[model samples]
Structure formats: structure tokens, C-alpha cells
Target: MRNQILGRQGEQVAVEFLQRQGYGICARNFRVPVGEIDIIARKGDVLAFVEVKTRHGNRYGTPAQAVNFHKQKKIIQTAQWFLRQKCLSEDKCFCRFDVVEVYALPEGKWQVHHLPGAFEC
Candidate 1:
């Protein structure tokens, strides 16, 4: 329950951060049988499939570190399905994978970090 709450909060912060950076949010919590993407946004001709990671502290490691190879594979598969669903050809549609690290701070504050092109499909 706590983890889910933190994840939701992180995703919201990531959406706001992307919007401020001139990216138009296209989807949130996009899920399929294969996997799920936290957020999807577009900037110009580029489509970004984002993975959001939130942590209250670095007890384990940086949040981005949690997205391992298996996770990346799942996200890539899901992104491909999303493009096909939208009738977008992979050859023509520019796409990239991104990671948004959200650190929960005291007093309802947060620190956000955006890593564009974090990984490839």
C-alpha cells in the first residue's frame, strides 16, 4: 500500500515535470498483458515512454537503478504495442525510453530528475 502510494505520487510529479519541459502527456499507467508504462509523452516528433521510480530514501539504491534489463525488456515490448495500437509505424515514429526519478521530501515536497533516452528498445 505504501509503495503504491509513493509510486502514484512520483508519477504525478513526473507528469508535471514533463509538461513544464514542453512535453505533452499522451498517456498514464498504460498497461497491457506484457507490461506497463508509467507515463507517455510527446515533444515535437519524439515519443517518450517513461518509467517513474520513487523512493523515500536511498536505502537500497537510486530509484533508477531498479529498472534492470528485464524491466527494460518489458517496457520496450509494451511501447511497441502502444505504437501499433495508435497506428504508428515504428520506422517513422521517433521514440525513446526515459526514466524519472522522484525523491520524496519532507513537508510535501519532492525532487525530480529526468533522464531522457535512458535506454533503447
Candidate 2:
């Protein structure tokens, strides 16, 4: 339950960070039969599918390091599904995959890092 709460907070931070960076947020926690996307945003002509990773410490590794090849594949598949569902042509618009890392500090403060065009399909 604590982890869930932390994750929710992290996602909120990610959304706000993206918005401040001039990305128009299209959706949050978008779910479909295939999978779920943490945040969907647009920047100019690019459609961004973002993954938010949150951790209390760096014991494991950096949050962006968690997005392995398998996870990337799943995110790509989910993005494809999302585009089709929205009746948008993949070829007509540019698509990008991004990662947002949120670190919960010891003093109850948080840090966020946004990696735009972080990965590709």
C-alpha cells in the first residue's frame, strides 16, 4: 500500500513536470486490453508515450534503468494499440517514448527527471 501511494505521487509529479516542459497532457494511466500507459502527452507534432519510474533510493539502480528491452517492447505494443484505437495513423504523426524518474528523498522532498525521446520502438 505504501508503494502504491508513492507510485501515485510519482506519477502526479511526472505529469506536472511534463506540463511545465510544454508538453500537452493527453491522458494519464491510460489502460487498454493490451497494457497500460502511465502518461500520454504531445509536444508539437510528436506524440509521447511516457513511463514513470519511482524509487525511494538508488539501492537497485536508477529508475530509468528499469525500462529494459522487454518493457520497451510492451510499451511499443501498447502505443501501437493506443494509436489504432484513437483512429490515428502511425505514419502520419511522429511518436516518441520517454521516461520520467522520480526520486523520493529522505527529507520528504522529491526530485524529477524527464528524458524526452528516451527510447524508440
Candidate 3:
């Protein structure tokens, strides 16, 4: 439960960060039997499938570090599922994967880091 709460909070922060940067949000928490994509946004012709990671400190490692190769594979598969659902082919649509790292600071504020085109799908 605690992890879910923190993850949801982190996703909200990520959404705000993207919006502030002028990305229009298309979906949140898009899920399938295989995995879930945290956020989907568009900036002009490029569509983004975002993965959000949040942490209080670097006790384990950086937020991006948590998204291991296995996780990346799952996200990629899910992204493919999403595009197919939208009837959009990879060749026709401009799409990319992004990672948003939300640091939960001691002061309760957050630091959001956006990594555009973090990986290929």
C-alpha cells in the first residue's frame, strides 16, 4: 500500500512536470495483462510513453536505475500494445519512451527529472 501511494504521487508529479513543459497528457496508468505505462503524452507530432520512478533517497540507486532491462522490455511491449490499440503503426507515428524521476526530498518538495527518448520501443 505504501509503495502504491508513493508511486501514484510520483506519477502525479511527473504529469505536472510534463504539462508544464507543454506536453498534452493523453493517458495515465495505462495497463495491460503484461505491464503498465505510467503516462502517455504528446508534444506536436511525437507521442511519449513515460515510465515514472520515485524515491526518497539514493539508498538503493537513482530512480532511473530501478528501471532494469526487464522493466524496459515490459514497458516496450506495453507501448507496442498501446500503439496497436490506437490503430497507429510505428512507421506512421512518431513515438518515444521517456523516463521521469521524482525525488522525494526531505523538505517534502520534489525534484522531477525528465529523460526524453530514454529508450527505444
- Candidate closest to the true structure, highest TM-score: 1
Tens-digit lDDT string for candidate 2 (4-90): 999999999888888999999998988877688999999899999999999997899999999999889888889998999899988
> Model 1 misses residue 66 by how many Å?
0.3
Candidate 1 displacement at residue 117 in angstroms:
0.6
How would the candidate models be sorted by TM-score, starting from the highest? 1, 3, 2
TM-scores, all models, native as reference = 0.97, 0.95, 0.95
> Any residue pairs clashing in model 3, and if so which?
none
What tens-digit string does per-residue lDDT give for candidate 1 at 1-121? 9999989989999999999999999999999999999999999999999999999988999998999999999999999999999999878979999999999999999999999999997
Best by lDDT: 1
Which prediction has more favorable lDDT, 1 or 3? 1
What's the lDDT for candidate 1? 0.95
State candidate 1's TM-score. Answer: 0.97
